[model samples]
Target chain A: MRRRTEPPGLTLAERKRQLVRDELGDAALRLLARQGFEETTVDQLAAAAGVSRRTFFRYFASKEDVVISFIGLVGEQIVAEVEARPAGEPPAVAIREAVKAVTVEDFTENREKSVALIRHTLQIPALRARFAERQDLLRDDIAEALARRQDLPEPTPRLHFAAGLGLLAFAGALKHWAEVDGHADPAAVLDAAFTEAGKAFAL
Target chain B: MRRRTEPPGLTLAERKRQLVRDELGDAALRLLARQGFEETTVDQLAAAAGVSRRTFFRYFASKEDVVISFIGLVGEQIVAEVEARPAGEPPAVAIREAVKAVTVEDFTENREKSVALIRHTLQIPALRARFAERQDLLRDDIAEALARRQDLPEPTPRLHFAAGLGLLAFAGALKHWAEVDGHADPAAVLDAAFTEAGKAFAL
Candidate 1:
């Protein structure tokens, strides 16, 4: 049950690069949420984050890549959270907790921001296409992490299935949360989704 | 259960239009499968289907739309199958049977064609983007059909969840089937995905 407060080891240069990337993500998300993704420009993103246009490119490939990198960061957190779970924890429980930990954090006070960002990501054709690809990669990452935690050399179908189900629950909850215009706590909605899935399967 | 052999009482003109559309879909799928989506031209598709190039636009909006229309046709069949299920069937079972009936028909002897079309659809950026949107619309359509069968005025969260899960299983099975280069029976793969979900949820 160890929690990662931060990565343990990083050179000063690496840490500085990580800081710049995080700053860009923060700025990009805020700008996109407030101004609409279609209208936002790379210059605006760079200016908002106090970085040059060249600096932004050094960190990310495009405006869309910034949002994707943000998602990738959360995915890495979920994997780390899963890896840090107790060895004896059930696979489902570990995945559930790991997903909840990362997602709930994203939706806390920044709930509306996250919702707007997600809406843009889903509604915009380019982002939506990338999102599907990201989901697949994230699912594999979760399954691989679960395999590692269980001391298995390779991920099994069962592990992949569990990862997929976890993602399904996450997606279902997000859909519900967005449908309600983010009025409900996403974490609570997620729990209900998991419960519904549990009940349906229990039969 | 009444299986619809054909839509009852189409005008001769309507039937003619339907035949032309189906012919185009068949030709488009075949050409796209063999020649690659990017390389295939509308002229070639029209020639193969024995139709004027202008008639292709009469039925579909674009090359990609032909593939989407093909998918939409199958989605309609899925909804119809779900609607036609006996009233006493459980929601999950009804959805499972409906999806299996329609999808299995699709993957039968035409397995390789399906595999190629699906691969092209997934691998091509424009098609992949549209596919994600199509999946969303199809989920709602399935849920609405389920709700109608249950005599509800609108679909419930449970029904939507059920629909989402069914699509998730279908997608997973498709992924597995494609991974094996279509060597496996898609229906059996789908059944395995559903069983795995049931086991995971039973916990």
Candidate 2:
């Protein structure tokens, strides 16, 4: 439901192509959640998004890729957000804010649908494997972001560990949030998880 | 390469069964590492271990299961080690010791074969997925271990976060160890990773 801005430098064709890609992703998530991930077909996704099957293929290689691509996009946004965080912030705080910027802001307005989609994604083995793969890349990107934020020459082991820990906290919080049917604000749960992690580490 | 004690309560037949299972796992790892995972078949594994194909099936459902069961056994042993840590040790230190007990002690004399098997496991998609799935269960078991150590009724969110963070550090350290061809002592790298994690969390 979050509307992403088309870059101002994009020409009409480029901007339209981006819009169509987003439409397909949106339709894919909805259909996958409603009809079930295993049951959803690529043709149905293309039809629902008002794009040709060929166009869908152009944007995404397969149905699994459609969902995986969305996750990849979110991961990239999270890394970008981390890089954009003010340099003075603590590493953990910056990482937390980066996650919050992408997930909390986007999901707050559509908690029910977000919860349904996340729950569905976790249930499918193919998606879970893909998610794990994306998570490995995401962790590395976060470590690099932390290094840049701290003005380090490159990511150190400590930075990588921090990145991994921060993401682990987020995952644990998200799992709990989804399990509870999103009754509590996702942001609050996430913050609490980070705070708990801080305490655990401090001990 | 690690030798496990048969539980004293087991009958002679049960002890023999356990030994045969261990033999198959050992043979599977050696064959999978030397010949490649996909290239190694069940018959080869059975032959290498001096067991019939039917007997191999009785012990393990498949070649992947042969590798995964070794991982599962290691995880269980780690949990048991955690339970056996000195009651007064700090939680992180205790968890670290638990890992050293299972991994450092077992792999020290067998570093080359361990590294080869680990590297191969990471390269195979099916094995990687199974590893991720096993990791999830392992994390939960670790959380339970932490909870029991602290006399908590159940695994708190903080406990789960700590378990995840601990495992993440181990994974990052192991990746580094294997990357460098295991020239450095695995325990030393693992310890440094945990120390770095401790510092990162404190920040």
Candidate 3:
């Protein structure tokens, strides 16, 4: 078996910066867990991570941003995946595949941490608001990808709306799976939602 | 044929209060149209309506509240209508009927104002955030109502998620209808969305 390691070819500056950001994120989450979100300060986080306040600012704008920074990467991956789907695939299928690819494998890896993050987000009203805004941005990105496909019609707002709702269904399913005791796998829950949504449409 | 007049049982105090709120809302919208949303002030609205600043606060907490007050009323009506649906109807059917009833009649009478409100809400960032929050509240309300129906199994969160998405589809259809140049009735638009959603679900 081969051990996966960071590529050896990176510039020193780029590698150091990535390492610093990772350290800062780990410190921030640890602080968030030990001391509540409201109690944790940027200065404290900086000290905990062995980084200066200036370095902390360079990495993250604030404590809230530290928690949500991963979403941007997730959003980019989803857009790429959706765009990469076969040209004539249906909009819903493209969206479902994108959501599944991003969430199932990604969520499974950090199931406990992700659930804790969700609980933390729900408890903090400000984080909750920002999280919802992030979701909206992701929805628009998905919608744009769907709209740009040559297979879709010119007035694609309705299709965009439907696809966005489908995404929400998957999100809701994941939330349920995380919160409920002995719940099914998040991916299975989302798959059921998609299937149920398809059945409801048929009615 | 008889000419309809004000009902004899209507109270003078109730009518006066309503008249004042209407005057304030009208003045607020007119000012918002002339100046931008940020430029408008509660005092200016009060002066325009010939009411004291105290009276303005009594009616609305802030300028943003004025734009969203109507939506609050509509949301309450939607929840109530959904809860009132016959016992035998499925959760989705009840939700669809409730949303249809609330939007169909209101849109007919207030088409122009509704469009203006939608456009204004979209343009203002604060208003847009509030709009999203309100939608979240509406989703919860619909989900709760669906949960209460005994015909369904103890409502899982996925059911609520599906219902919430259905409501969003209805809302998205209405919004698109308002945007188009010669779109037909909003009710028809909602019906089409419901039909499409049904088809999506294979319901």
Q: Each prediction's TM-score against the native?
A: 0.74, 0.78, 0.78
**What does DockQ come to for candidate 3?**
0.21
Predictions in order: lDDT: 0.78, 0.81, 0.73
The residue-by-residue lDDT of candidate 2 on B1-203, one tens digit each, is: 33465567776777888888888888788777778888877899999999788999999866678877767888898899887777677668888888887898677788887787678667786787677667766888988898888788898887787787788777777778889888888789989888878888664
Which of 1 and 2 is the better model by lDDT?
Answer: 2
**Which candidate wins on lDDT?**
2
The CA-based lDDT of model 3 is what? Answer: 0.73
Instruction: For residues B1-203, write the lDDT of model 3, one tens digit per residue.
Output: 33345477556776888999999999998888789788877889899999998999999976788898888888888888877888677666787788888888777787777788877876687776666666766777777666666455456655565566676676677567767722477777877776666544221
Q: Where does candidate 2 clash, by residue pair?
A: none
TM-score of chain B of each: 0.80, 0.83, 0.83
As a TM-score, model 3 comes out at 0.78
Docking class of 1: acceptable
TM-score of 2: 0.78
lDDT of 2 by residue, A98-171 (tens): 89989987778878877876776677866776666667668889999988987888998888888888887887
Q: For each candidate, how many residue pairs have backbone atoms clashing (under 3 Å)? A: 0, 0, 20
| Order of candidate numbers by lDDT, starting with the best | 2, 1, 3
> What does the lDDT read for residue A100 in candidate 3?
84
Q: In DockQ, how does model 1 score against the reference complex?
A: 0.24
